[model samples]
Target chain A: MPSELELQISPIVQESLVHNSRTLQNLQSLTASLFGVSAGILGLESYDGFLFYLAFSLLTSALFYLVRVAPSSLTAGPRYFRGPFEFWAGGLMNGLAGFILTWTLFYGLVRA
Target chain B: MTWISKSITTLGGLLLAHACYSAREHSALQSLRAASAASLTSLPSVTTSLPLDIIIETIVATFIILLGLVLGTRPLRPIEWRVWAGKIEREGEEGFIDGAGEVNKDYMGNPFSALESRPNFVDIRKQRREFAEWVKKGG
Candidate 1:
């Protein structure tokens, strides 16, 4: 339901996509360091819940960035996302990332 | 009575959440401690043998969050007309725009009249008016 006047997506969407793709790549790389699985095979792994969410985040981010950065439609996604989905997804990403960080650091101290 | 009721509700909620968390932690630590204490033979300890996979996963996740927070820090510069209009084009500065269209720099380092586009304090009101117009137009 975007209006005709809004021409481009916001920079935030591109930023989100970059952030998500990087995080997924980071996670994929971590599998190798922690489990000795090659990075290539990890990329081929089936989409279970965690992997699915991870992949979703990456793909969506990439798609958002791709659509947004094309000069004309950059603001389109942001305009459409003036509703709950944007707010909710942004919240989820921030919240999950924050929780994992706080829990791990404090828990790490406890164990150490 | 209203204040007292609200205070009691808040206190109850806090106590309930605290108790639940304490219970979870206490069970994990207390049982492990009791089990270790009951062991008759003293074995040489190397690593803690806690599940490394879970630990690392948690740590990595936390670090990702922290990295975002760390990187997301933004500067707090206040926006002023002289600061922003300088971006469009200085009064007489020069720079290459897209597709070979050239722009002159303003005193602001904007592509405008690079020499004098930046306002002296003498023209603060004019600068504010221009800035207001820019903001009204969604700049």
Candidate 2:
């Protein structure tokens, strides 16, 4: 079922995959911490307003960690999330989450 | 992102801190909705004046944000490794990784083992190569 264009991984690349796997695990843990902080910051005052914010935060965390960290390196990237979905998605999530949390907090203060 | 990440995180963090400090109610009301007859009597006439609590919160938030901006760009006490290893971003949260995967205790806080066994030199060499390649790739 392999396509002709699908490049076979080299042995060194295989070894690198193991280390990268560990690194990805570390990255996932770090990401969870960041998202938890962001979500708490967003939802701290009122429970109702930031459902999307918190939901997106959790969703992004799960997607990135599962796709990028839990899978084998072959699935992650020939280029380490930079090659495909994770790259842009990761950046977008970060931007949106950061924006919403910050925006709500700032405006919320003004209202207060 | 390079320009805005620090500012946003700092400012956002400060604003978040302010929210934590201010009025007990975090209602989404655009205005003080306790604008009913009895509540209207309770509302101060010069309502535009920022409450002292809000003022203090704002001041604290400002200081925190200013400090974060200043320190984010500057080098404090150096870690075991001089280089920053990597970064991860997701859902608007981004973090940096530096000074990781060390071996020496004096240099990097390793446990007393120098009474220590030999390290896997070959693996380290290979990892070093991959890490070098990672840098070359502009990661």
Candidate 3:
């Protein structure tokens, strides 16, 4: 039996939600790696490298909202952002591990 | 691909990984020498001699891993109304519901509208008894 919550959401809305999440994951991971490479090449130290990653990943999230999510989703939901944590802040945290991994590897390389 | 093909590919990858690992170990000493000469940081250098090469390697590895994640996984199948509706209507030769199911006989009216005017427990029991008789009679 379908629950009241399940019955309320249309199939199209479900599909859109899934699609948005997949796109966001791809964007976040890719940008995190790229940011790591830039930090490594620039020879940024520990604190500065992390700061750079945080800033860039937030930028990626903002771009994702403006370009892909805003026009289609603005009128439908009660939430300000499409997903949780309101875009930039959430994506920055989500991508932090990936960013750190690449950043550390490259930092070791350039600084050494 | 088939299981055999996938296993073969995995074995090939394992071989490549082993080879790279051995090569990386051999080059580590040389890289350390290069690292010590470069800057003030005492962090150990990886396989590459130059910083640019390391950056490029990181980028390429990221792209490859991202590509594998996107394409290597099985895609999700979304549930759609039309597909289930077609199965209910028996419009095609093949559908999700099999012939053994009791629902093979199509309902005459919109089924959802009937939800508001549903049969009571007594009515349902009486209908079940009638269905059992019909099955016994091979109808």
Best by TM-score: 3
Candidate 2 DockQ category? incorrect
lDDT (tens digit, per residue) of candidate 2 on B4-81: 436655675767455554443443332455455346576553333334565455434533443333223311111111
Pairs of residues at least 3 apart in sequence or in different chains that clash in candidate 3: none
Write the number of the candidate with greater TM-score, choosing between 2 and 3: 3
Given candidate 2, what's the lDDT at residue A93? 39
For residues B1-139, write the lDDT of model 3, one tens digit per residue: 2344345435544543443343344356666676686686666555444345544454344334333333332222123444334333553323322223333233333324456466552478788999999999999
Per-residue lDDT of model 1, residues B79-138, tens digit only? 223323442443233322311244422123433454565545358888799999999999
Give the alpha-carbon lDDT of every model. 0.36, 0.40, 0.51
Q: Rank order by TM-score, top first?
A: 3, 2, 1
The residue-level lDDT of candidate 3 at A47 comes to 85
Sort by DockQ, best first: what order? Answer: 3, 1, 2
In angstroms, give how far residue B42 of model 2 lies from its true place.
Answer: 12
lDDT of 2 by residue, A1-112 (tens): 2243443422123323334443434433433334333334333345533553446445544554453444534443234322344433344334444545565654455444
Top candidate on lDDT is 3
List pairs with backbone clashes in candidate 2.
Answer: A93-B91, A93-B92, A94-B91, A94-B92, B105-B110, B113-B116
Scored on chain A only, each candidate's TM-score is: 0.27, 0.34, 0.71
Per-candidate DockQ values are: 0.04, 0.03, 0.11
Chain B TM per candidate, please? Answer: 0.27, 0.30, 0.30
